[model samples]
Target chain A: MDIGQTLYWIGLAGCAVFAISGALAAAEKQHDIMSFILLGVVTGIGGGTVRDLILDRPVFWLVDPLYLEVCIAAAGLTFFAARKIKFKHKALVWMDAAGMALFSIMAAQISQQWHASWMVAMVMAMITASFGGIIRDVLLDQMPVVLEPEIYVSASLLGALGYLLTCSFQGVEDGSANYLALAIGFSIAFSVRGAAIIWDLRLPKFPPPAAE
Target chain B: MDIGQTLYWIGLAGCAVFAISGALAAAEKQHDIMSFILLGVVTGIGGGTVRDLILDRPVFWLVDPLYLEVCIAAAGLTFFAARKIKFKHKALVWMDAAGMALFSIMAAQISQQWHASWMVAMVMAMITASFGGIIRDVLLDQMPVVLEPEIYVSASLLGALGYLLTCSFQGVEDGSANYLALAIGFSIAFSVRGAAIIWDLRLPKFPPPAAE
Candidate 1:
């Protein structure tokens, strides 16, 4: 398949992963089926929706709604599977990391397509990668994982910045090098986030003020 | 003043109020000034941003950015004032209710202007009216007020539906009836939400199913 087709499939997979993670999060609340679906769909689309809004682009899900269908299907499947399978916390984290990697790269690519500045592209990529999970946690009444002293947003940021740097350094004015850049960017994001999860990595906290 | 100018001023006032409410919410966390500004700006503009995205319109603040300035100014003021004043819980609630009322009417009117169906208008209105506070609560790691079995969203819904009903019944094709409708809509929303806050009104809980 061409690069466009590859990216399309990967984006859908990312949405599915995010949706499943959301359903898993909702499992903690033991909410009803509708709640699972709602949470799943919102988590899957919330980030990209916000990104598109900020960028003044057409909302991705609204343009086609196939993304919404994918999220709904994923949520429904997870809701049923959750009845039998005890979802592990690690499994959820891994899935979230994967989703974050894919979304971060894709969002960076889209931002580049829109001719956004490097800073805006990186910020958009981070938002697109992280905000979905944040929305899910909020809806579940849990502290968002991003707000913790974790490496989550940092990983996404590194990946997005890596993607932009790869494109620019390779002189991708004709856009021929974007496919390789996308892969490299995705890999960087996933590896950093994955390693952080396994090694329990965290960013350092601000030092308390010196005693008077 | 003309209705257009009146509405414009009210919208700015609403943004300021919402921004202050967000800053007040952040005071619970005692975060730095930057966090206060971020939270306040997000709460002030987030709902309308979502509505504009869904409606495929240019985002309101992007078109002018005056709203952003208002939010930032309000947040900065609140941050300083918080050091000197003990903010009351009741004050926040009342401010939130007023913001809800103003935003609900404005959103309903905008939906009508965009020629949305009654149901779509009501839903958009509720989303625009409530999502700001929901986002603020989420960022603060608090349970969203809308999800707490309260009459918040219902009040917005009622007001939006009331506005549309009044417009349609009165044959508002000429658009001259909109000012009266806006006033009525705002009054209904504020009265209902205010009453709920004063009396601790609540929606009924689901009854437990009978044993087989």
Candidate 2:
């Protein structure tokens, strides 16, 4: 199979995983079916929507309905199988990491197509990777994962840099380079995040100073 | 005062009003002080940020911190006065209408400066007037006002059209034309909204079809 097609399938898988994670989150909160479906759709397409809006392009899902269909199916499956699932939180984090890594590379690649500066491309990648979860958390009335002094944003940044570096080295001539870079990026982010979860590695927090 | 200076003052007052409304909303939710402050800042600057971001211009508040300071002061004042204030919701709607009217005109005027088409300019105006409150509602886990099938979007559209029509008639030289248009817009929106609230005039909802 061609590399681009392979990467497309992998990205779709990532979307499905994230949709399941979103459904699990909503189920944990005991939301209705409509809310669960809404959350799933939002989580699956939210990153790409923001990226396209910021870039002044039409939304990706509007151009192709596959992403939306995948999200719907994932939500439906999760709704029926919620009781069968175990280790929900662990699954969520891992799936989120995969989704973030995939989206980051996709954003950077799109920006590169637009011939944006490297810095702008990197920023777009980070926004695409993290802003969906941020919006989700904000809507859930919780502190965004990005603001939690976690390694989340840092991992996304690292993944984006890895993708950019790979693209720079091998050039865009070989389609396989894209897949290779994405794999490397996703592995880095997921491994670091998994280690963080296991070892409880966290960023330092500052306490409020004494009142005068 | 010159017409430009007068409009600027009115716009600043609108900003303050929206800031207060934002603080009141936060107070209702019983958020922490910092969260309240953040809400105020977002409500005050969110519209302009969305406008500038869509227009691909530098964000306005980042260029001038005065807007931020004004919002912060307004939030602090509202926090202290919230309990003592009577008819808070009424005040919020009136203040929001004023802000929406002013922002709609400002967005159109700015878009005209950019030499954008009238259609694009009008859309930008509507976005600038409504996006902040939409973001606020979305963050608060409520349905966005824009999606409520109400007169909110229509009000902003009409306000922008008013500004454009007045400018055309006055040759953009008559200083009073701006304020006249703004006043008309605000009055129309506020009166309609107030009547709706008082009389319980709601848009018709779609009835569900009978199950088979």
Candidate 3:
């Protein structure tokens, strides 16, 4: 496939992963089907939608109907199939990490295309990678995992930084640079996050402050 | 002030009101200053940002730095001054309603600029008026007030519909038509919401579904 096709499939894969993660999160809440679908769609599109809103760009789902349909479809699949799957938590964490890794690199590259500085690109990557999960957690009345010293946001940041560095240092053509950056960034995030899932890795949290 | 200046001040007023409401909401959580500020800023701009994102337009805060700055400043003011105010709950509801009224009309007008249909305009108005509170409630792990059978979203929808009707029925020029619509819309929202608050009005909730 060409560059455009490659990116398209990558983006859709990210959305699908997010969708499954959303359904999984909803399952924890004992919510009904509508809630599952809503959570699924929101988790699938929330990050990119927030990014587009911040950047004042057209929402991809609105312009292309397929993205929305696919998210709902993915959610429906999960709603019926989730109970049948063994090792649900393991599946969830790995899929969520994969989604975060893919979206982090893609977001970093897209931010670069928008001529954003490295700082902006990295921040966008974090947002694009973790915001969907944040939305799901919020809807479920749970603390966002990223805010809980989890490896999720840090993984995305590492990948985003990697992507930016590769682009600036490689002096390659745009197309090749993006592919290479994506490879490097995705690898960094995937490996680190995978290790985190396996080891239950987490950052340290500060003790609660004394009462005023 | 010309129309531009008029809208600018109105928008800032809406932001300030939202900022105060956000701070008030955070007070319920016993959160620290940073969390308050974050919640305040998110509440002030969250709705509009969501609207712009869904519509695929530039975020207003990014284009004008003042909006962000003002929201933060307003939040800080509330952080310091909230305790000193008497009748705080009354102040919150009144100020929030006022903000919703102005933002609903303004958002409806702005959505018209994008050539959205009346349906889209009203939906945008409701989003601009209520989404911030939704975000705030989500962050606080509380149910959104708009979902509590309150007249909030309904009020905004009513106002937006009134605005569109005025535009259609009146043969006045665009400028004058906009002003008149704003007046009509604001009046509808403000009076209804005010009465609701004073009378403790609420729509009946659906009876709970039987357990499966």
Candidate with top TM-score is 3
Per-residue lDDT of candidate 3, residues B1-212 (tens digit): 68778788889989988988987765555444545556777789888888877887777776665776787788767766666677777787898899889889888888877878889889999999999888877777777888877778889999888887888788532433267778898999888888888888876567734532
Against the native complex, each candidate's DockQ, computed on alpha carbons, is 0.12, 0.08, 0.14
Off by over 4 Å in 2: A171-177, A206-212, B1-49, B52-106, B113-170, B173-212
The best candidate by DockQ is 3
Judged by DockQ cut-offs, is candidate 2 incorrect, acceptable, medium or high? incorrect
lDDT for each residue of candidate 2 in B1-212, tens digit (9 for 90 to 100)? 88777766766776777777777776666554444555676688779878988778766654445666788789867766676667777777667777777788788777877778778878998888888787666666667766775567777777777767767776762324366656665566556655655675666555633432
Docking class of 1: incorrect
How many residue-pair clashes does candidate 1 contain? 0
Off by over 4 Å in 3: A1-20, A23-46, A49-98, A115-127, A134-212, B19-27, B30-42, B49-95, B111-124, B138-141, B154-195, B198-212
Alpha-carbon lDDT, every model: 0.81, 0.71, 0.79
DockQ of candidate 3 compared with the true complex: 0.14
Q: Going through the candidates in order, what fraction of the true interface contacts does each contain?
A: 0.13, 0.05, 0.20
Prediction 2 TM-score vs. true:
0.58
- How far off is each candidate at the interface, as Cα RMSD in Å? 5.3, 8.3, 6.1
| Residue range with the least summed lDDT across 10 consecutive positions in model 3 chain B | B171-180
Q: Could you tell me how far off, in angstroms, the CA of residue B122 lies in candidate 3 after the best superposition?
A: 4.7
- Please write out the lDDT profile of model 2 over residues A1-212, one tens digit for every residue: 98667767876876787787788788778788887788888888887887787676778889879989999999888888886778877777777877877777777777777666565566567668766776667657765555444466567667777877887787762223377777776777677766766787764322112211
Best by lDDT: 1
Please write out the lDDT profile of model 1 over residues B1-212, one tens digit for every residue: 88788888989999999998888776666655545666788789888888888888877875666787898899878776765555556667888898998898888888877887778788998899889998888787778888887789988988887787788878883334377788888889999998898888988767734532
